[model samples]
Target chain A: MDFSQTAERISLKFSQKGQSVDTKKIEAKLRRLIEEFGVQPAEAERSVTNELAKEFNLPGIGTGGGGAGKPGERENRSIADVTPGEWVTIEGKVVAILSPVSPSIAQSGIIADTTGAIRFVVWAKANAPEMRQDAWYRIESAVIDEFKGVANLKIHSGTSVKPIVEDRALIPSILKVGELKPGIGSVRVKVVQEWETTHERMLQSGIVGDESGTVKFVIWKEPGKERLKVGAVYTIFYALVDEFNARLSLNLSTATYMQDEGDITVSGGDSNVRGAVVHIAPGSGLIKRCPVEGCNRALSRQNYCPVHEIQPGFVYDLRIKGWLDDGEKTYNILLQREVVESLTGINLNAAKELAENNPLGMDEVFLRMRDTILGRYIICRGREIDNRLLVRTCERVKMDTGEHTALLNRAGGAP
Target chain B: MSNGGTPAQGRKEGGFEREPARRVFAGELRECRHQFREGDDEKSPTFVLLPTGERSNRVFLVGTLTEKQRKGEQNIFYRGRVVDPTGTFFVMAGSYQPEAMQQLAKIETPAFVGVVGKPNLYQTPDGAYLVSVRVESVTIVDRETRDLWMLDTARATLDRIDAMAQGLTPDAARVKEHYPALDPAMFRKMVYEALAQIKI
Candidate 1:
């Protein structure tokens, strides 16, 4: 069959020098065989699958044994005699990336290649240190991890690794996108738009796209802050998945993390996953009225006792409503007087002056001079309760550079 | 009549006028001394008290009473304000009243009168300030009040939510899809479920 069109589509989703092998075609052929025979679908499909395996010189069905090759059972290769927990190394091009949110899927993940995104076990965070998407690396004995019915090699200390960074470069022929998942090392992505904060400066989520797919990325740098140049592309690495908000999500946490790199870029992954961009609205933060430390009670009128009624009293507290993000979600954060004082250089007196002059208050002044803040990206790892969602923050590494360089840094990141 | 202007003098209860009211013991010893002045009368407007200082989480004091210096009356309330690091609270007092005098006389040297009246604030002509709380009968209380307040405060501290990790849930393992599979609110809802069990 002329699979040129199918191959081309894979190229758009995967990468340039590489593309995913068309699993759909294989499945389709297997289904046809099943329909033609009166036997069980699994039985008919396996028989036909075995014939194709021989033609492609693929490992024969149930070759490695001790473990039975039953229906829905792992294929026991006869020659390589490996156990379920045993680690083995497979040097292959990364077929497909789980698209930042696949680990929690089906209890593990599936990285497709000329083979298909297979279930791979990455038992710990440190395992798959070098096996990024679209890159060629030697994956040692990653258990058979499954996701969405697909199989992949799991990364673990028990497993092995070595980087052949440019497996994409080694391939002599043009590759389609579908075949590029295993090859995902780093890919250039454009910043489409970022989600603004309501309570204060923080990011909810961001959308970026490439020729392959478009996906959403959440931020907590500052709710209403974090300016992004539209269409600015950067590289992304090692972002996997977890379950979030009832459905699955591309989690950029401990297991899966994303970075934006300005220089080189990679491609997309998976047939069903579409990288879509989102334009979320900005959020709001509460403004506070400040009081003078020594003379504040006069305004309160009722809080003053007999003594202050004679001499003059001054002083008051300031507080406001802010926002925090729980992943790509938003939350309300209460900015008390102490927190405000620490965050802003202004003291109680200066803030009062700012408040007196502007009806919006001191925070508004900070917002107006926002070039110094607001848009700055921050690392938010520590989690706190914000509104209802947990607002998380960690130390972020920020660099003074052009939009181009900033994105490049993010692109070259690891989990 | 605690807020009704008077020095620390007299008690109308069964203790009845208890002794005519002495000099130091005649008036209530005020904790927030910032409100007192020499030439003030028995009345001031209103005032506010933020839950600040040592008693931060427990007290929110706002009262209406006479600042000794208001109405240009000469009174003896040496101090007027209490600076609870959280914020300052003002106290207004003068000489004495029949009821207040009763308590002052019975209590030993300068003692605290757990205020029963609200707060009163008065703005002076020269931009000075006078703040105080009307006095009520003093009661001696202890620890339980403090604990409940602390509990209320701890309850207010908020926490954030992240999505579920692999094997995070004790049960349920299903093949996850990235796109056609991404459900944004599901994790948030899961967090709510977890939070439901927690309370102060």
Candidate 2:
């Protein structure tokens, strides 16, 4: 609403360098950029400052103490306002400190304000003082740069860091399991399952779920971190989201969690797998099940159930126990009667009829079913439990000739 | 009946982990002349280095069974020529693979068949190496299955070619060293040609 305050701030930056400034002219430019042209206040300020620097023949305007401006005179810009290639001051809490991959990067982590959060890197050459985690710092003259379309700050030699006191806490917004990508976020989920710890470095690993869906989570062995109890709800903060085998999982190595009072009603989400039915297990096709109400276990050739003993009046069912190989990994898939009947066009009644007429009995149905489905490429969708996909639906994968043709054409091959 | 009851685990015989069967076209399968084992031990898995920089221990292929011949009176080996769009893959089913041998013996000629097996390279006295599949399982498939396999193999071949073109990883370097005159364009052409056979 008022341009004189913004104009005075800009004039003070130049005045600190002993340059003669025009407050009226700076106010007019800010009014034109913000009111007439509809530019964001911070961006407009930067554009007008760059223009004034060029006009006054002062290229070193915002380069901290090295420049004409004093070290702490520059106003701190909102983290959301900073754009790439501009030098601005930002005051935000250090929410996360990630392990730097390269030696040239002395520290790399996430900084957050109430507006938004962004990645920041302190270069080794900057020789800046270490900023404590969870503490607010006013970073002056930090250069903004972009990597992979996301904006981040690059603290170099010219940047000055100072600890500041702030009352309000800046907490990142919580994200649902379905909305997660490969990044950092907070989530509230109940521990659905705790799987066996596969490695010595793994403190705990399990499936966590919320109202939206479930996701696998792993917490590496870290000091002062507690294990998560199954079926207990918790709000996890600053968890690193990682992707493996195209599936997203939360890595809680550097995260903190708090037990929540309420519970989450999780949805048994479905996943899809596409591959060839490489192998069919022996207990497939027409099988005799125990007639007992709660016991439908497959009966042996002698019409005996393992738990319920011998059962003469056995119910017939058609199913396919097989492995689906998607080139990289193998999924143990259990295709129930409905899915098997839909895929092979052999219903339970037809399987029973085939077994009754043949001298080989149930083996005939197994052989026929294997011939119908094995080596065929299919896509199955269902919920995965204990590393097995309980296939709800199965369909043969039709070749999309047009897509392949386009792909080949793009690869510079004759199509 | 108890709902959500766990199904029986269909563990393969001997309980050994099965190798992932890589999909490769008949043309690419025929060109896999370099075969090497991972270790010197007899039990070490052997892999055939594909020209597109993939080392495949087992391959799943679907093609038309063009011809079949029953050889050796005592051993009774069944050798079949399976033809896809690009080329023919020779498959052999011996006594050790009785089920595959039986299936191959009974299958009619010119029928679409799917074969999952390991590629074996044998050197003749004249020093010419011939690649053939030691059939693990053979089943009668339909035209749609064969067409789908072609598309899948095309995608897989293109992925390997793309990986090889991107950079020389250890596997890609091994492929380059084995096939000194390897040209990714040739595999790309093969994939295109394989896909062209299938109608929309």
Candidate 3:
């Protein structure tokens, strides 16, 4: 390709600053870099301009590379094909905008095309116009860099970002909960559990699932947004997926909801967690529940329920409210009477006898239960609801000597 | 379960998530020499920086309770030594942990036990820091349970060692700044030795 036009653009940039120009020398350098070394035309222009700027004692000038060529001159590459340390242009929709972690980063988020999605960052020095989330943009001359073993685009002052208005929709195809990564997608899920609104900003948050798996979802309070009821199925469009502690969840801040007919057979909420009973919280062991038909609330110290009036004749129950730690994560487990009785070998009648015989009264039963189960390694199978596991079955974990031996062999081989 | 009233009313009021308890071997646990708080508030959670570059607010361990002694005349307290496969862990339970103290007082010596508690760093007069577990809860366990704990702890330690070797996450990077002389191989060796104690 001819280098005169490109060289003239470089000379005009320096002349705009009232600096002396060397058009012939610039053209020769660009020709050598492109033809001999086979550097990308855009990269070659940047290198040559940077060289000229230093020769003229200019530090930051020519770094933008705006005078390189027209927008259509550079090749447009897919997100998946771009590699680190190369200058390439990519056209993708802004999938998600993550809050910037540093002052130097003006914007940082994931951008995706039909091929795949990749993280992108716009440096404060780039001075590029802010790209709205879910909008399409054609970013030119953006450098690729790697962080945490993942390649991402780095938009600096040399890059040019122009928003695009595509006639076709860039929305990704529907995905199952198990197939979700950190991006934007659509999914049809059943609202399995509804949790109390913990914050004013949260309209609702709960676990949603389908046959594939279950995932936590949060709906921020917004105008004209419909709340999802438990046991109802809905198809969510354009929901942003986020990950924390290696677990994925959905954020429906900028998403659309459609109530779907019928129900889904959910599968993923059931978990089998094995760990020590680190804590046997209070209100465990022998307790009384309000006898008023539908009101099963645990009675207070004086046999009074918050919602129901004083009930002198309350029904007795057994349960264990505790925390279990499986090394990596802790689970809040609620063990019902049957599971607690099987594990502790203390039935409801036996617990009532202990409470009546001891001067400590009901507190004695709690003490006895704590002595029987605290710090024990037990496996519990149950459905997780609002971060707490409602255990259906539980038993002490048996040591697998063969497993330990194999683990030892593998660990010994590790470098 | 009926929801007329929620379980753990006190925990509901706070509405904050609990910090997970990490499983670390006593050998590696003793090597932790740094402690930090995430914020300036007194209520901020304190974390013990593990040698493998992770932080633990609470730790779960199972070992053999070798001995025990009760101290403090006015306010009774209990101190015990628990021996795991790799090394010994000192546990203390005072009035603050009445349940643990009571449990410790009743348990006999040389019995298998499980403990979950926070790590407290005590600086000696000579300027060296010593680590011990402030007992949260203690219970009797079987040899099989202790062996299982050893296996789980070994796996967790190896995972941390690998993460530190990669040095990818911010936790690993921050750990490098504090423990500059830290070596992943040493922790790997510790894991191997700990696992070797559990015989099939």
Candidate 4:
């Protein structure tokens, strides 16, 4: 079959799903195409077959050089064909996309077409661009093959792809605004709040706003932490639907796919809100039991992830995610590790020794940031952390109840 | 003996439609040989489905077949499987005669028949807790009996659909009129409604 036909077959299989399609079925179709495409390399035959299966180091289907299945299979064979290695063109609509995960980069996406959902590896790394999530596209001359028995079709430099449409148009879905809780991939939101620092495990919290609504988005300890700014809003290209506390929330886990290079230039007065510390418990001011940043394992604590097992010195720091009551509602914030260490001049090794010597030795640390963090008004900046609107703490702050009244006024989009 | 040459029929108001030849169900019956007390004079019937004729279709052979003893009082019982489209259900007989036992022994796996008996439904810890009906008066009949039953079932199914389709249907209210105990006749009408919808 020709490339346009191959593209159409795969796209159709994709739209049938009420939601996303599975990855394995797509790969199989690619394998069928690669194996079935090349008949007798007569100039015309080669061109037609090549449209179905692009050149790849990956094993191509062995049709014994007789040729990919006759042109008749085009009308009959679904993208699910068991044909081992043939280049057969397939196509369809992009009804769904996979939440990109990686050995490769952040936000690796998968697209689907008619014949079936073919798993495609995007060598074309980019973020949520002008395209719509459900937009239809035609990928030309992409190599189709099986990886570890799974059929995978990939688009790289050698592959050609074009977003398809009619009536002076391009792209799939019209980007909407609302509180995005993850799966709703492309959205526009604003900075609602930010927490200082929580777990020694870096985590940023914020609320994002959109036209339809606003919801919390969280950006976790992604690769590039320096990329965020407070009070700035921009388009969030990709986010994930995840579950936490039995409820759904959006997460921006892969740093690469947290694509909006644009930031909201919006800002507000830098004030500190202070509240009385409700409570403090064990591990409050404890020394850095975890290994330093370069250090893989926790120096003494078990709360760290296992992937960091063998590294150099670690960046030992303390973090507390606590509630502060300014006489009304209680809010949350994360005090950074460095701030915790700076606030409490004790180094990791010394703190550990002190903690071991006296169980409550770390009590002083929480106390310093307590009142300042509690009743003090924290300077607020908006940033999307983990696909959320976070009030990044600029400085401890508090505004007069009357001024705070005015603050609530702007929340509704009033000037 | 019209087609496959077997005798079985579903229950209908009218009696068997065919001449009573050497009907598979014709024979002398037997009574329970054992008895025991069952909770303040109330006891449960113990009839195993398809028992190979309780030691071969005879409850009282001049000579004893085996030294096995049963325990139940007040009712003469027999047990067998009744195959239906919904699946086979184990049936019991509280007052059937030895002829019923003889018929059961002669009947094959897909036998069709009309039976009568009070049902006692209970639950097992596992199993979907499905109710098993115990059938009595097991008999073998001719093709005419089977056809009559199918026709009756088809008619009954139609009545139910009509009643259900009614704007002023008194289903539950009419049910209470016969009351306390469900008049199976009414519910059986529902079963017929279910059957008639199936394509022949």
Task: Please tell me which predicted candidate would have the highest TM-score against the true structure.
Answer: 3
Error of 2 at A171 (Å): 28
Question: How do the residues A1-415 of candidate 2 rate in per-residue lDDT, one tens digit apiece?
Answer: 8988668767877886788689999999999999999987656776788788778877766343234554433767777666665667888888878778799999988787877666789999888999878999998878777665556788877678989998677676888988886656679999976654666678778789887778899987767778888889999877877765556788886577999998788766477888888888988998888898745667888997765679999988888888888765577888889999999999988888888899998899899888988988899998674356768898988867686677657546433
The lDDT ranking, best first, is 3, 2, 4, 1
* Highest DockQ model number: 3
lDDT of each: 0.32, 0.78, 0.79, 0.38
Q: Please give the DockQ score of every candidate, comma-separated.
A: 0.01, 0.20, 0.31, 0.01
Candidate 2, residue B191: lDDT: 72
Interface RMSD of 3: 7.0
lDDT of 4 at A193: 53
Candidate 1 lDDT tens digits, A1-415: 3333322322222332233435566556555655555544334434544454455554423212222443423322221233232223455555333324445322233343332223454554533463565566555334443344323355644344676654433322222222233222223456543433332223334555555544445443422223345546544433333333322223222122234546323233211110000111122122321143322222222443222343233344544333332112233333345544544444567656766788776445444322111212223332122112112222222322242232223223211
Give me the displacement of residue A408 in model 3, in angstroms: 1.3
Better of 2 and 4 by TM-score: 2
Better candidate by TM-score, 2 or 3: 3
Query: Given candidate 4, what's the lDDT at residue A382?
Result: 35
Among these predictions, the greatest lDDT belongs to: 3
Model 3, range A43-133, lDDT digits (tens) per residue? 7878887788788877545454455543433668877677665557889888767678899999988787876667788999889999998
The parts of candidate 1 lying over 4 Å away from their true place are A1-60, A65-89, A93-143, A147-151, A155-188, A195-205, A210-214, A218-231, A235-238, A241-354, A358-415, B1-200
lDDT accuracy of residue A145 in candidate 2: 71
The TM-score of predicted model 1 comes to: 0.24
